[model samples]
Target: MNNKEKADEYFSKNKSKIKDSDRPVYHFTPDIGWMNDPNGFSYFNGEYHLFYQYNPYDIKWGPMHWGHAKTRDFVNWDRLPVALAPDDEIKGQCFSGTAITDNDKHILVYTVHSNDKEEQTVEIGDGVNYKAVSDKPVIGIDKLPKGFGGVDFRDPKIWKEDNVYYCIASAKNDRGFGSILLFESKDLLEWKYVGILFENDGKYGKMWECPDFFKLGNKYVLVISVMGMQARKRKYFNGHQVIYFVGTYDKSSYKFIPNGRGKTFDFGFDFYAPQSLYAGGRTLSVAWLHDWSNDLTLDGAKWCGQTTFPRELKLEGNDIYQMPAGELESHYKNKYHTSFILNRNKEYIDNDLNSRTARFDFDIENIDADKLTLFLAANDEYNSFIKINMKKKTLKFSRRFSGLCKDAIDERKIDIDICDGQLSLSVLVDRFSIEIFVNKGKEVLTSRIYTPLDANEIRFLADGKLKIDVSKNEIE
Candidate 1:
């Protein structure tokens, strides 16, 4: 059998070793092995299919393959078979890319990582198994423009406008920085270069990767994950960051002109390489719920990495507001809501609202306080907290007490704007992750926690009076 067949057999046999209790309830992960950077999120066969960078032989990243999963709604997922594998003939692994629907056939254009150079190739399949359209690379090293090299040319983001197809991939030019080169194709196999879409100005980061260019509302947005950024301020905290640029894709000139600057896509500790899909009149997205780290979850659960909960994105005044996919409401079991005045030096603990797998939507309408803190995923032995400071206009999230990790990141702080002395916070707590949306996605924070599953407690503490209304729902 070939490498693809061998991979499929290996995953089919090994996935049974993992239990459902070991995985996140509402998030997507690999069947049994390592999963990273979501690739090819598109609608086909009446369902949404997400392809991810997969390594099935072990619980850590290795020779890359494409793992597949499908969902009609965003919350519930049906794991599909391993889609693509490194070919023994090509002697490379499949990297990252996007997909598009072509006349009932799902077409994937992705990068193949070889010994030295990376190249672009095509694959076509039904929702289950995919094969290469051609054994040879379409955009090989010879076709690259002057100053463009082969190794960094990967993560092809493709979209269709009118009858022509457009694709962009990140490449490091001779200038020693990153540039996004645009190309167009009449057919899926052949492509022609169309100038640069956007190039790095040297201030953002180094090589940009996993780019997504799409239209949201009346504005065109370009999303990219950058490498080699240093953490000097509130932004670029990850060093490797996922950021977005609001601009116009001048179809006439085939160039993107930014309005001003790029903004942080997610102000969380663990978010990168996110891709967006425009489906059903909504712009939906999901990112790898991880950052660049040598110490992942391989030693802990024999399973590593997860995808952020799918979000519905919208453009409201050059800012993207993300709402958890509406399909999640079907999983709510026991929901309790309360409105109260939390005075200074008072602590409020709700037994009914404490759950690891739950959702809390709380609004702090009237604030007369210097500080507010919420302890979540808490018990006597372990607790994680989000502390908001009114004078500092900042919020800090830390998971150091949730579990012990000497090497991995445990905390992050971001600038928060509380308009009119009011703040709305939506917290989605899973068995191993916490997703917080501030003021309906004005600023969002996502982090992974390793606390014991039984440590499910929610407590509120404040320094001064505040009017709060909280709605808690148990979501599996």
Candidate 2:
């Protein structure tokens, strides 16, 4: 049997080995083994298809396969068969890529990592199965100009303009800096290299990966993940982080002029390789919600890693604001609401407001308060908490006391500004992770935590006075 067919068979046979309780209650974890980096996020066959980097052999990453799953709504997922496996090109493995749909055809453009070289490859399928368009790479090292390196060239994001297909890929120059290279194809078969779209200024990072280019609202935004960046104060806390540039792309000249400094969509420990697709008239995004430098998944947990809750991306001017997809609201149950004016140096704890699988949203107006803190998954001695300091204009999220990962990253902070002493915060807590949106998603933070499942206590504390409106929605 072929590699893809064999992978599907082995996955089906071995998936039953993992206990159902080992998986997250609401996030999509493949039936068995390790998964990372959401790929081929596209709307196909009237369903949202999200394929990811998979290695079904164990809960740790190994040789790569394209794992497939689909949903009519982003909340309910159905696992499909394994899509692509290592091809017979000197131990080649499939890496990150994107997908697009035209009529009845579903096309996948991905990177093939073989030997010491990385190249772009293509496949055609009808959502259930796929085959490579060519026996050889469609765009390879030869396509890059004089100064680019082949080792770091990967992650192609494609779009069609006036019947011509264009692609952007992440590559490194001879200076060891990352560059986003552009290419074009008449058909999907062969491609011609366009010039570099944007190059790193040596300050963003060493190598940039997972390039996604598209227009949002009135301007185009180019998103990429950076590697080898040291933490700079409150930004880029992880060794790798995701960032984007708001700019304009000139189709005639194949150039992108960035408006200002590069900005990040998230400021948390475990977010990388974000991919965004335009479907159903809105921009939807997902990313590998785990960091490579840290592996804190519980010991003997038969699976590892999941995508961040899918978010809807909206752009106003140059800033991109994201919130949980609207589809998530339909999956919530046990709705609870509470409103109270909390006095200075006081604590408020509610039994109905705490859950591992729930959503908490708070709207607060400062009444002589300098600090507001909300603790989640809390018991008397353990908890993960978010602290907002209006006096210092800062927000911090930490799981340091959650009784896991003593040596790994446990806290993240971001600078914030409260307008008119008003703040809107939304927190989504799954069994293993939490997402925080601030000021209607003008800023966001996402990370994974592994606390005791029974530590489901919610508490609010203030350093001074505050007016609060809060609600909890149990996610089913």
Candidate 3:
């Protein structure tokens, strides 16, 4: 059978295995099998299209296809059919890439990986139907950098600037160092190699994956997912971390002058290979919410992997601020509110705040506490805690006691300042994940936790007196 016939039969036979109770209400997950690394995120014909690496036959990663979905708003999604599948000639997989709209045609540029060579290919389609633009790669392996082998050449992020199409792809040199290659094309069918856009300075990582370059505000931002970098002191972890560099782009010379060392894009354990699109005058992004280390927990479920909530990216100074995007308030209901003052060494419990899927907004003032702790997804058997230290200006998330999972990363901490003795926090909890936006997205944390399905309680404790106003919205 052909590749399309195989995908159709796989979907028809295994579609019933997916269970609604195991899926998240607000996040985008595959209906069956496994998904990872969001791809081809673009706004086309008044709708947002999101594609990802998918394996339709099982809950584990395997041969990859382009799984497709679209949404009018970022909150609600409609899953489409599989967009692209592996061909017999490729005999490997279709990896991650991006999409672009040129005049009237929608085009997809992606990497095809096999055992011997990695090549770049293209496809054309509307939102529903797509066809391969060419049987051969537009940018073939012979066209890559001379000294560098084609092992790590993949993930082409394409965009247009001044009527010229630009593509940036990740690669590793013969010396086993990571770099990003740049290419320019007058038309989408042909391309010429530009020089290396950016390379690691020996401190970053051995190989780079998923390189995205675009202009945000007056500065250009480059986002890369790095592999094989050792964990630094209080910064990124030991493997597969996404980082971004804010800099100036000289369009005349096609060179990037970065301001400083890149910063960690997200401080959570679950975010990686995020792709962004410019839509409605904003740079919006979404990421695969599970990392390589946490993939073992989803073995029993029929479906695995999910995307993080869409975030609006804003550049402030040298840093980027990310917040929940596109009117999230519309999905939340059953409002609850309260105000209280917590004395030293006291605890407050509100049964009304309990929910499996809820949004919590806290406004804290006149803080005199050395530390404050909030427990979520709590029951007699399991709980996850978020601890805030006012004096040290640090926040920590701990899931050590969160039930049903072991041998995963349990703690993540970040240094965040309290402004004018005040803190504003917004927490979104789904069935198996928690996303915390601290001080209005100045510092954010996204993590996954596995608790008893019945654990639905909220608790707050403080070391000193503080006035707090809290609101809860249960999301359907």
Instruction: Put the candidates in TM-score order, highest first.
Output: 2, 1, 3
lDDT of each: 0.85, 0.87, 0.85
Clashing pairs in 3: none
Estimate, for each residue in 365-418, the C-alpha lDDT of model 3 and write its tens digit.
856788888888998778899998888888899988887456878898888879
Q: What shift in Å separates residue 216 of candidate 2 from its native position after superposition?
A: 0.4
In model 1, the runs with Cα more than 4 Å from the true position are 298-300
lDDT of 2 by residue, 1-476 (tens): 87777878887787777876766767777667888899999999789999999988778898988899999877679989888889675258999899999779999999999768999998899999888888888998999999986998999998888899999999999999999999999898889998889899898888998988988988999998999876777866547888888999887788899998788879877789999989888998999988887878678777887998889999878889999888888888999999999888778987878788888899989999999998888998788899999888899999898777546888888998698889999988888888889988889988888888888988889988899999898988
**Model 1: lDDT of residue 316:** 85
Clashes of each: 0, 0, 0
Q: List ranges where model 3 is wrong by over 4 Å.
A: none
Maximum-lDDT candidate: 2
Name the 10 consecutive residues with the lowest summed lDDT in model 3. Answer: 292-301
lDDT of 1 by residue, 235-327 (tens): 666478888988888877779998877888887778899999988899999999988853647455757889998899999878888878888
- The TM-score of predicted model 2 comes to 0.97
